[model samples]
Target chain A: MKIEKEPISGQYGKFKIDGIDYRVYWEEAGQGIPLVCLHTAGSDGRQYRALLNDKKILEKFRVIVFDMPWHGKSSPPENAKVGNYKLSTDFYISQIMSFINGLELVKPVVMGCSIGGRIILHLAINFPDKFRALIGLQSAGHLDPYYDISWLHRQDVHGGEVCGGIAYGLMAPTSPESDKFETMWHYMQGGPGIFKGDLFFYKFDGNIGNEIKKIDNSKCPIYLLTGEYDYSATPEETKSLADTIGIEMIKMKNVGHFPMSENPKEFLKYLHPVLNKIS
Target chain B: MFKSLIDDNEKRSQLSIMAQYLNTSFMISTIENEYLVNIEKGVVKNVEEGPFVMPSYVFKLTAPKDEWLKFLKHTPQPGSHDIIAMLRRKVLKFEGDLHPLMSHLLYFKLLLASLRPVENKNEN
Candidate 1:
């Protein structure tokens, strides 16, 4: 299928919270039950610009998309500090909540992709009442013991110094060579300091699996899409997660880490149930 | 501590046995390939010659270009990045044994993982 990017409009601005000023870029589309889509790391909400172009979705709920701090139109804080690094997750969540509260978006169905999913899962665990539903696409939760460590060792030995391991090795498969995506692709590998900082973020010892189990008691239910070939959260892992959380799990056949982007047709099939549950 | 757990002779023999098994069971060739193991052994290994391709029965990964770019942009030299970029573009091809070579390599990798200080009690 031919995919095209659509134009979106939103107020580009900044907000000061916890003594930090963060650039908040947001766009609104459609008009029913509000749905907020958070994009993943390396890229921004523009990734969802095409998804919003759907007339049916436009007719259903108001769709809001935003860029996280340090990605897309959002700017990383000048003179960022070590303390600021620790608050990365907390800051993003609080900013999102503040944004939701500011717009009076009545418990919108919060959807996230990749790190976006990680952010939403954290939100669901810490503040379940704030959201009506959540749809995590290729949502990354915990590191699998089989987590692709070759890449890790490669990055470690390279000292964040080359693209042979990260870009050409890991990112190239998913990245398109078309001119349209080139700018975003370049922006993706723009800084190594940020990439190095992420090494620590992945060091989180907190068990999200345990937090996911907390959803069993939540009034707000979660619908997760586990990619068949996804090493991040394999079907088995999701099954374990579902059983632990006491929720129905949906597995997408023949899909991987970025199912929504990799195999949209199959991903759409898995998504129908989630859409039904939330709607 | 790791040496105490497994006799050094036993470990060496195990490595030799794995190498022999790989040397005999699979064909080592000029074609690039990959292998995956679940036995707490080698998890990832790529043997490529002139180019990179998604091999069958392995965790298929696209060449990591973003990572390559990050390296090239910061490095003082230019030859390495050019070589990797060429490989990613399939200007090169690789040759190796898939399963047996993986088994042999993993024997060493697993030994490393086991010898490391255990961080989590849940680890087997």
Candidate 2:
């Protein structure tokens, strides 16, 4: 006896956040508390498309994922005139705040990867008692060792190709060819300078090492699941942050920055434990 | 021309807010010598011709004096106008972090293009 592949799907909509009408393209499944997922820089909610369709996880939590402005199907804010769409701390927060309020979610669990992971710190630290829990993937209190990829902006080298190439080095060498291409394919669709704009927060604005002290664990429990292959925010870096903030840290092996997208099946093995603990 | 261009608070503020290419500096080098241009939050603080104490820059863009003069002309020829064009043509050589150079492409392009003297066709 054998089972065939199951088709994955999602529901989508649009919502206004911070005076900007963002086209919210998202998927939701199962029942329980809403688990809002944020994506890494350059890429979009598509990064979590796999998780949204996961059966076991879907059964326990209502999964949600949306693309940021200037990413995926979402429209950029009016302030984004030409190549001027920069993401600020206020804007990033407002987007999430508005989304949560818009959907009328009840103390939803916010999970993010990379810049998504980075912004959760700001959300958790500033809002404090707002969200139920924060699951930061490839996150650090302060993301050090940022690689400047400006040279890749030349016409000779396509920005998307360059975007995909840089991320290629970070993923596990043993990852499936299809999975790696799928992850790289998302990056291949990044908007001009969008990657750099996100890094501004990932590297600087979101580097709230000292700010983490302000966070009260009782208000929102923080769980960091960093990828071992993620040099940008390695396990060592996340461990240091966990040790400093006194939160739980899990080192995800054979995966890089985009765990949910890279090896979702293998990633679930590590994620299940954390989800159970929080539940 | 450089002074007035950099002094324009509107442009600087716009660049800072829109691009957030803050606290970044680079050296523009001609065959004659080098000039250190330091910008903080998009405001140009200093532009001094180099060969001095503790000279530093994120990236150094080098070209011959004549080529620069030609590139900075009212209308530069093919492969002489843009920095990337010049680099592609091997007319301009970079000596440092290319990230800032490429990342803040427009700012630097405008900064260099600002060197073009305001043309007054009727002037004798």
Instruction: Give the best candidate by lDDT.
Output: 2
Best by DockQ: 1
Residues A1-279 of candidate 1: C-alpha lDDT, one tens digit per residue: 798556357768777656677777888787888889876544566657645665656667788987766656667777864323332666667777877876788989898765666676777788888778987665555653322223322223332223122322222222232422332353344333443333334325323755676664367778777665444444665666667767767776655455545445556667655666677
Model 1 DockQ class: incorrect
**Native contacts kept (model 2):** 0.02
The list of candidate 1 runs beyond 4 A from truth reads A1-7, A81-87, A144-190, A195-199, A202-206, B1-124
DockQ of 2: 0.02
Model 2 bad stretches (over 4 Å): A1-12, A152-156, B1-124
Q: Which candidate achieves the best TM-score against the true structure?
A: 2
**Which lDDT tens digits does candidate 2 get at residues A38-74?**
9998888888867777777777788888788788887
Residue A269, candidate 1: alpha-carbon lDDT: 68
Give the local distance difference test score of model 1: 0.51
Q: Give each prediction's DockQ, rounded to 2 decimals.
A: 0.03, 0.02
